[model samples]
Target: MQQLPSNSISLFCFFCMLLSSSYAKPRISSPAFAANSCNFPAIFNFGDSNSDTGGISAALYPINWPYGQTYFHMPAGRFSDGRLIIDFIAESFGLPYLSAYLDSVGTNFSHGANFATGGSTIRVPDRILPTNEGFGFSPFYLDIQLSQFMLFKSRSQMIRQRGGIYASLMPQEEYFSQALYTFDIGQNDFTADLFADMPIEKIYASVPDVINSFAYNVKSIYNSGGRSFWIHNTGPLGCYAFVFLYSPSAPALKDSAGCVKPYNELAQYFNLKLKEAVVQLRKAFPSAAFTYVDVYSIKYSLFKEPEKYGTSSVSHTTYGMEEVRINTTLH
Candidate 1:
């Protein structure tokens, strides 16, 4: 990931980068393969709400209306009013939006399956989910997601070999090795720690373990036939609307973008460590390709200048994309 030591200066550079190009593309870790050269047959995603295509909604209760209304014209399990980044990624590859592995009804896993769920964390939370209480955290943490992927990989092939109508929906065995494995988790780990009333120092101290757990899962996927990895670092937690409402800070404690200063700093620190972990992964698995996308910088830029991105305000909840307008012709 690119370093952004100072929010002000980094944001200025971000603006310049945006102006220089029509689309603000992600920085790729490797340049050996050009975009057109990649012919990804499928995309297997593992992450939290940021990349979740409806795992939580399907596993638990369905996401209520207005969530997928913008793009899907109804509640299509996504937490957004429109499609997510993952949806666009799938479309870019000429593949359909991934079916949630947890969803049983009308699912076709021929292309790929998504193991992501809302509120997922890199580490296990103090309170495991599947409770009678309302939503808090997901039981399908990164490790759990990994387990589901393993099972899906095995069971999918088993069913496909049976040679029935159902088997047609399953992906070809070769897809697993050639697919692009995507990740967009870890934000919830920090948020969960903060909500549990843990001190900032303690949260900072736990960074190593968090990154280690994430690395462990990535390696496991690599072992499970995943070769190409596209990992997204956590976004700007400080700019989240929930943070402003729940963890109010003085004007002096706010950044130029009006986000809580300390929280954004913590996010940047997490991203830095995550980037380092990706570097280590590359060294260990020389045959595999790892692409680290600095989503935090991109999201922060939008929050810093909402008008530039078609959003009138960044005060809306980060989990929802109701404010961000997408052109019908383009989307």
Candidate 2:
């Protein structure tokens, strides 16, 4: 895995801190806040590899090298070499790193739980066919992750109702209501379609359905007592090492930034639709605090100006891509 530059890491952490601190403030009149004024107590995350903590590792056992070398010095299930943006966000709130929901051993749920899994998509494709691009199917789609969250909520409520030792802890409603609900999904959904060689117009046509399902899921969380949300739109998929290196495109079609033009256009279109959906959601849930983050621009900055970020390299080598492809297939 390519190491994120120090400057890029700093910017990422700063953004996370801003979002966490801004959204975690208690809304005085909302039921999500307790009588005691406290910083947000927990965070519930849903997404893919970009924010995955250990769901892949917990499900597939140990992952390979270079996955966590930068910080952990060992494979800790993060797709990158060190802490993800979510990890920095947790730290900003003075909370321990959130544990993957599937992880069993040495797991602590006091802070929060991550439902993200590598390869996950907002919606599962009808059928997954192997492509030269090396993408595959993921059973842990957004709906499944949402189901897991609902299960967690149900189990916690059951424990509270039994008057168990945990009952003295924060109430289920207040805990979930005050918790920061974050989403970093939708990339794989579009990527799967692209890898399948679906036409651009067809892929564009699917955006509404995709965002509708996403909106419904958000509403479900709100009905379940969540009051604060931090939703990250899809990043620049065209700028990814695999897409830039392998996707067939004429030299004339490449953008000034050296990214495939069509792919990046699709990503921008999706982000626009997602932002619009968030606006509708804000109006729908007037009591909730919704913050939409433009992750594409942030990540693109690192890709566009690696030297400025103190990184020796930005794109991946052919050997590196092959290695990642093999490891992704193994999972």
Candidate 3:
């Protein structure tokens, strides 16, 4: 149960406050408005496993625990022991946890839908794996996720036009347009390159193209009438168990933070370019309110002070990769 930092929590709260003020009108109000002072109608998320609720489950079932042991008491397709940061954000806004877009049965998506998938990348890489089986390219890359979102919007619009249950809740346009749009991707893109043994320089060089694709997707969503965005930068990849297990550097090259210096540097480089691209995106969409969340700093704090965050060991927060490796090998 890795928790978001207090500062990150406050940041999200501040965003909610801003959203409340921006959407509030003097003329009309409803019971839902009275029930929750800051009633954001919906939330839409795009990301990798960091925010994936159940995309993996819908595609591949019987994923074993301790995946969702903390919260749901059963595997719920999230990569962690409990809820993701996005789940908490949704709860703070008085919205239900978003259902995975691919989840078919018993899913309530009136509030919003999640298009994130495990192992999704920002862009499909040019190089395929060198394995004899010719495997390991992410099928649900950001572009395809955006396309799925477009389809979701279309279907929701059709349902609204047909006077369905969703039409009573909110207009499809408003649902898509007013909902908070969030992006928490790009980690897998770097990880993919790293796993493929691409040169470090070549991996660094891919940042611009990755950010460009991300920015383009943002603009596309803006064109579709989205006006608010919360973008999370990549966290400290070097601190994760996967990095320690598979990509360890020399002890001398480790940072004071206990993370491999080179891997953290790569993450920082990506975050830097991402922030710059977001600045340009703000210029491109004058009406959109873009909030860049510093997830790297927040997550690094957990690594720095695991005890303070209610974890006896840092291993509790980041054993996903280790679990995956063990499970895959066992199967």
Using lDDT as the measure, which candidate wins? 1
The sequence of per-residue lDDT tens digits that candidate 2 reaches over residues 86-124 is 998887668888889888877777667899877677887
**Candidate with the greatest TM-score versus the true structure:** 1
Off by over 4 Å in 2: 1-38, 127-134, 160-173, 250-252, 317-331
Deviation from native of the Cα of residue 319 in model 2, angstroms: 12
RMSD per model, one decimal? 7.2, 8.0, 8.3
Clash pairs, candidate 3, are: none
Whole-model lDDT for model 1 versus the true structure? 0.76
List, residue by residue over 1-331, the lDDT tens digit for candidate 3. Answer: 2344454344445554444445442111111111122345788899887888888668655446877876788888787777788999898877888899888866777888899877677888553332244334346778988999999888777877889565654335767766788899988788756655678999898889999999988889989988778788888877776765555443456777677778789999998898888778777766677777677776777667666666644553343331221111100
The C-alpha stretches of model 3 lying farther than 4 A from their native spots are 1-12, 15-38, 125-137, 164-171, 248-252, 316-331
Q: What is the C-alpha lDDT of each candidate?
A: 0.76, 0.71, 0.70
lDDT of 1 by residue, 36-56 (tens): 235678889998877778788
- C-alpha displacement of 82 in model 2, angstroms? 0.5
TM-score of 1: 0.86
